[model samples]
Target: MNQPHTAQDDGVRQRQQQIAANLRALILSGDLRPGDRVPSTSDLVAEYGVTDKTVQRALAILKAERFVEGQKGRGVFVTTQVPTVVRASHYPVTSSEEPYAWIADNASRGRAGSIVLLHVGEVPAPAQVAAAFDLEIGTPVTVRHQLLSLDGEPVELVWSYYPSNVARGTRLAEARKIRGGTPAVLSELGYPPHHAIDQVSARLATVEEFIALRLPQDMPVLRQLRVVFTDDDRPIEVTVMVKAGQHFEVRYALPKPE
Candidate 1:
C-alpha cells in the first residue's frame, strides 16, 4: 500500500519548490548570468530560512535541469545553456535575400540554427487542426514534422499541417528541409501568409516530447498552436510547436497608442 501524505512532507516539498522557483527566475532574467556563481549553501539557507536539506534539494532540482552545475570546490554556478527568448511575432516575416526567419533569428543572436525534417506524409487532421483548416474531422492533411536545433542542441519539435490539396505536389509534402521554409513556398504557390494567430500553454511533457527533447525529467513544456491565414481570410496552415518550458520564453511587443 502507498504511504499516506503528511503535513511535514508537504511543508518540506513546498519549501524546496519555492527555493528552486526563486533561483530559476534569477537565472532566466539574466540576474545570475552564465558562469555566475550561485550563492553558497549556507548563504541560501540563511536567505530562505530553510534547513540544509531543503537548500540541497532545491539545488539538486536546478542541477538536474541544467540551470546550474557544481564545481569540485567552487560551489554551484549558472550553466552556459541559458534559456532562449523567442520573439514570437517577428520570426515569421521572411525576406527573400535572407534565410528563413528561424535561422536568421538564431544567426542574429550568434547561434547556429538548423532544422531536420523528420517525416512527411498524408494523415487525418487532428480535431483542432481540422477546425483551423475548415475541414471535417478525419479529413486528410499533409503533415511535416521537424526538429529545430540551436547550437546543435535540440530545442523545439514542430508539426505543420496543410490541406492535402494544397500540399499534395508541393515541397511541404516532401521529406526534406525546404530551401526557404514553408512560408516562402506558400507564397510561391499564391497562398502567402497574411497573418497568424497563436495560442500558447504549458503542461507536463508527453512521453514523446520528453524523449524527443531529452529532458532531464517530466518537466513542463510550452505548446504553441498557430493558424496561418492567406488571402480572403482562408486558413492555409496549422502548426504545433513544443519547447522545453524551463529553457525557453516568448516575447510579444505591443504597439503604443497613436
Candidate 2:
C-alpha cells in the first residue's frame, strides 16, 4: 500500500504554500514594485502567525523563480529585470527580405535582441546531431554556438551545425559573429533554407546548462531541435536550442490535413 501523509506534515506544507502564495500575489500584481524590499522575516512571521523558517521557505520559492533577489547585508527585493519572451523554432524566420535572419524572435515584440557568438570550430558530430544532419557519428562538422540575450539577460543557448564539406571554406567556418545572419550566408552559398523541422522536448538541465542558463538544479530545460533543409530536402543546417524553462513559453501552429 502507498504511504499516507501525516496531518502534521500536511499542515506544514499548506502553511508554507499559503505564505508563498500571498507573497507571490503581491509581487505579480505590481503591489510590490521592482526594487521594493520584501517583508522581513520577523514581519512576515508575526503577520502570518508562522515560524521564521516558514517565511524563509516562501521567500526561497520566489528567489528560485527569480521573482525576487536577495542582497548582501540587505533584504530581498523584487526583481528589477523582466524575463525575455521568445518564439520557438516553429515561428517563421524573419523573411529573407528582412536582410538579417539572425535577429531574435523577441525583436518582433520590440525587445532588443543580441546573439553573442561564443565559439566556432569543427567538432565530431554527436549521435543525435549526426542523425539530424544525415552524417555518420564522429564525422567532423563545423559548429557555431551562441547565446541569445534580451535586454542584457540571457534567454537561450544555440548550437548550429553544418557539414564539414559544406562549410569548409565558407564564412560559416569562421570563429567570429556572422553579420546579416546564417540565411543570408546560406543564400550566398546557394543553400537558402526552404523548409525546417522543429522538435521540442523537456529534460533535466545538464551541468553546463545549469551554469550557462543560470537555472536551478531542479528546473527543467526546454529544448528545441531545428533542422533547416534546402528545397531538395538536403539538410544544410541543424540548430539545437535550450532555454531556462521558467523564462519561456513555446507555442506552435499546425495546419489541417490536406
**Highest lDDT model number:** 1
Backbone collisions counted per model: 0, 0
Alpha carbon lDDT of residue 150, candidate 1? Answer: 81
lDDT of 2 by residue, 1-258 (tens): 533422233454467676766776786567998899998987777677777898888888888778888898999999975544445535345464554454645666667767788999999998888998877999999999999776666768999999989899989999887666777778889888888888889998888878887774356788988888986899999899998776776756666999
Query: 91-205, model 1: which lDDT tens digit per residue?
Result: 3765776657788878988899888888999999999999998889999999999888888878789999999999999898888877677898899999999988888999998
Model 2 poorest ten-residue lDDT run: 2-11
> What TM-score quantifies how close candidate 2 is to the native fold?
0.72
* Native-to-model Cα distance after best TM-score fit, residue 216 in candidate 2, in Å: 4.3
Candidates in order have lDDT scores of: 0.86, 0.78
Off by over 4 Å in 1: 1-17, 46-54, 95-100
Please report the candidate that would top TM-score against the real structure.
1
Count of backbone collisions in candidate 2 = 0
